[model samples]
Target: MDAFSEFIRGITRDNPILGLVLGLCPALAVTTSVENAIGMSVATAFVLVCSNVFISTLRKQIPSAVRLPIFIIIIATFVSIIRMVMEAYVPSMHAALGIFIPLIVVNCIIIGRAEAYASKNNVFFSFVDALGIAAGFLLVLVLIGGIREILGTGQIVAFGYTLLSLPINPAVTTMIMPPGAFLTIGIIMAVVNYQRAKKRAKGG
Candidate 1:
């Protein structure tokens, strides 16, 4: 397999959120700002890469009938590690993300990739696939978060760095709220679909 292609595919062609529409709960729940998005992204990425390696390394030994349970165990183990590290060092981010960190244990993105690709693939390819999907998730989370933070608060701050600010009232605080997540995702999906349609029409 072309390793780079496999990696890039997750960032674009098969984005878990934009293309596959998976794992919306945490995507919306914690994406109130770029910092939160990045926090969740890193946690998920760590779990994905570690789990991919752990599972792929044992693919041959894991019995098919009981593979799913094994995968969950491995994934949960890594998730627990992540929780501890976050709680110890980045407690603010850990507190901000809260249960969502544990929620990563059952995230469809993690399990689905573990089952569909990591289980059947070699260790290198599985690692690349997991990283690719994690990158895709990070990209979308940051984009949506940037929008919500800027519009909802009339400014955007990431990791204590101010990226942008407006001297006027916020556009709509609801954009950072639950309902706004659906609206933002809906608009983004619409734009993505439109671009796809245009590409198809141009025979590209």
Candidate 2:
């Protein structure tokens, strides 16, 4: 429950995507490029952090019978704000993300945290939890996007900048397709599971 442990858990043990396997819709859809992954992650983080804090602050006043609706309302408000800001400043990415942006209102990670953590914790702890989970979300999305972009296009491009290019010619185009997302996530999950199993065997 300490801040540091909670934060680290989000990135490692409790990762929203890799660990908990939540929020896969956008994780698979907008992760074709690192830039899009970053954009979506940041937007989700904003909404999550804002809603977490707001819900935590009013937990005492919210009725249990109506908490779910209240959580959605709070989450939707922040989602709208971030959507407008992105549309105004980063129109291309905004369009790239498309329906997934509005769909953040229903993202399980955010809604789950609001009910399971934010509603039961103090504002500070809720904020910490949100930050941890958001960081984890960002990390996994970026990893998936980087792998896809590099394999699919043989290069990494972000916001008009080419970060890295591989010597491979005619990249595996399929890597950028839907199946590629599934393959990349599946491999990563397998590797993670293997590592965890190894640790368990050694009594760690």
User: Best-fitting candidate, measured by lDDT?
Assistant: 2
Residue 77's C-alpha lDDT in candidate 1? 97
- lDDT tens per residue, model 1, 66-106: 99999999999999999999999999999999999999988
Q: Give the residue spans of candidate 1 off by over 4 A.
A: none
Taking all chains together, each candidate's TM-score versus the true structure is: 0.97, 0.98
Q: What's the TM for model 2?
A: 0.98
User: Which residue runs does candidate 2 get wrong by more than 4 Å?
Assistant: none
Clashes per candidate, residues 3 or more apart or on different chains: 0, 0
Per-residue CA lDDT of candidate 2, range 83-151, in tens?
A: 999899989889999999999999999999999999999999999999999999999999999999999
Native-to-model Cα distance after best TM-score fit, residue 35 in candidate 2, in Å: 0.5
Candidate 2, overall lDDT? 0.95
lDDT of 1: 0.93
* CA shift of 5, model 1, Å: 0.7
